[model samples]
Target: METTHSPIRPIPVHPGLPVIGNTLEYLRDPLAFFRRLQRDYGHERMVRINVGGRATTLMLKPEETKQVVQENNRNYGRGKSFAILKTFLGNGLLTSEGDLWRKQRRLAQPAFHRQKLAILAETMIEEAVAWADRLEKVADNKPVNFSTATTDVTLRIVTKTLFGSSLGDQLDSLSTALANLNHFAINAVVNPIRAPKWVPTPSKRNFERATTQVNNLIFGIIESRRKTGETRDDLLDMLLRATDEETGEGMSDEQLRDEMVTLFTAGHETTATSMAWTLYLLAQHPGILQRAKAEIRATLGERSQPSADDLRAMPYSSQVINESLRLYPPGWVMSRLSLGPDRFGDHAIAANEGVLLSPYVLHHDPASWPDPEHFDPERFAPELSKERHPYAYMPFGGGPRLCIGNQFALMEMQALLIVLLHRFELRPVPGLQVTAQPLISLRPRQAVQIYLS
Candidate 1:
């Protein structure tokens, strides 16, 4: 592909303070700022803004977003946000680019294959059952913090499926450390300017401590697996046995650590957040909840546990989750950098400029989703979804770089819902209104308190 020599039209500039540009406004409230930009400037209208004195092009239309992520994806690479993430995630599948990413993605793809997912479905149901049992023991008409509960169960499931263990007593500490690391990463992305890692700023020092603890735990898991020559048919086993077809070499210990941490970080939070939001949505919408229960009950009959086949039969359950994701997608924003001067739609994107593809903005766009604020699972009904743009509802993102664990995430969500909804009716804790935090994943800013009656 050749870069056209034709002079490119200037993208409309969003006026900002000299030097700092849009950094402060964006840092204060990114979703609000982006939504304002989208409303003021119409869809497909490109605008130039600055982050840490760097020029970034904010794209609004799904078509332009498609070009950046799918059609001309090669011309764009994971941008600044991911660069900040590399400090923690290292050169794993999430942070690596080019051939390294290609090779890593290929080697890991088989582990998430359908057969593996089908096998994992039973484990998800088992975890959900255990979680419900714990909930039942404590349900005394008091408001339960659903957010904490879902995160706890999801983390357990990920540890069992990926590491082949529950991570023993370190589970609590590891969760805390990962949360600290994620907070630091999000702050770094928004604040832009920061002291170097060695400078010993309070945040930097804390980040270093968190990284050290997480790395030790992950490396310990790798060592234990290697020493035992474990073969549980889990992700760790798949990775340990994986050999590059061309190089005919297995992953190094460091490489294995990187991938494990990547999966731990990637797999756990997003899906957990998705489930938390789904519960909140169902609680808020009783009609939708009842309809979903009807499908679940009708599909499962007398069985308390849902099999892989039972999950497949509950399409409404999936639709309810889908609709919740549209309203509060965990992975709300996707970023890219133009590798060279490129054309997306009719606009010329200059080399090295940053591009943002915000699912929050696109998902809520009135043109694409009518009464976008409403909780309507029917929108996802097969016949209705066909009318929308392929990229219009991107919860897990799109293109070759789309989330590899998409099916795994969905299956896990379905299993949890089947077991949870069967046992409990989640009602809102009086007067509390759940709000989106819009961090690394769109988490509930407040504790989502629900009465499990």
Candidate 2:
């Protein structure tokens, strides 16, 4: 006997204004718009909404989302959405596609291997301990903007780990240039009407100047390393020594710069933002905070620094970090462009269309998470987590292109939390409202003010 299959249907389109479509609604407030879609048509699996004069499909179901990002990822390339990022990153692992991406991924893989990351964890703890000591000296029961504090510490850690050198006098200017460049890139992504690149708009000029500043700094490091032939067992050293298995060739200076900058850009702020959110959430929930503290005390005893083995023993602390990431994933929304036709259950998607998969939306789905808005780390307890879909809680993303530094980020967060929580008690500032700002990463709109006593 032959079996019959259901007919494929066109994806449902959300009603929108002519030409501009849903762009206005999206621009006004992106997360709200996404939540509204989930509330209204979430069962539809896929819904099409026009943004900036183009139709983009939103993948609403976890199963379909998994297929697009993991199983059929080849058909969904980085596409035009990453063009602005490419202007700065220049075909780095984050933005590259096809053979170049494959080659880059291969060359960079060994640096993140388990043994290598074990060595890097020491630097993470050292930096976190240094940061905690500095805070103790100046905190004096006054509110500190932990967002800024975490950013500074994480930048230091990444600088030491990646280049094996301190920024020294160049730190402030380099930080400012990256900040300006980030602001420019994000604005360009959202605004539909952009002046030609040749036009010297103030924003464009700033972006160009920032790009030059960053390029010069990175190239200077590369030149110095080549001339000196020094070895520090840092990421740059590994990259310099890494040879392609296929051709026995190493990355050129330009390639090294791109990867280093990419790592710097993607690595630092995302970890810092997540740490700030974790701190904010802990401040708000004293009981949960105490539980994490108890676990840390039991695991590490009187040790000021947590080794890799000690970090692995703190299960509750890891759960708190996972729960915080679910609430405020730094890489909130991920985009892919279709290289060919595809189907999600009964719905069909055409070639060249843009598809969005939001970890933020998936994480907050009521089907997978009961009382989705509640902050409950117990939801991640092993027994409960085993029953949930794997894709339901992907804070670092999923599949072949999953963030390379995910383990590095988690270990860093765990180490910092252990050191800081051991030394001080965190309290929230009264009458302050913290909101999430969606940028290159999800960050707090204002400083997350907390007092240490």
The 0-to-1 C-alpha lDDT of every candidate, in the order given, reads 0.86, 0.89
Clashing residue pairs, backbone N/CA/C < 3 A, model 1: none
Alpha-carbon deviation at 140 in model 1, angstroms: 1.1
- TM-score of model 1 relative to the true fold? 0.95
lDDT of 2: 0.89
- How would you encode candidate 1's per-residue C-alpha lDDT over 354-409 as one tens digit per residue? 89888898888888999988999999999999999988889988988888888989
The clash count of every prediction, one per candidate, is: 0, 0
Instruction: Looking at model 1, report the run of 10 residues with the lowest lDDT sum.
Output: 3-12
Report the Cα lDDT for candidate 1: 0.86
Worst 10 residues of 2 by lDDT: 3-12
For each candidate in turn, the TM-score is: 0.95, 0.97
Give Cα distance to truth, residue 321, candidate 2, Å.
0.7
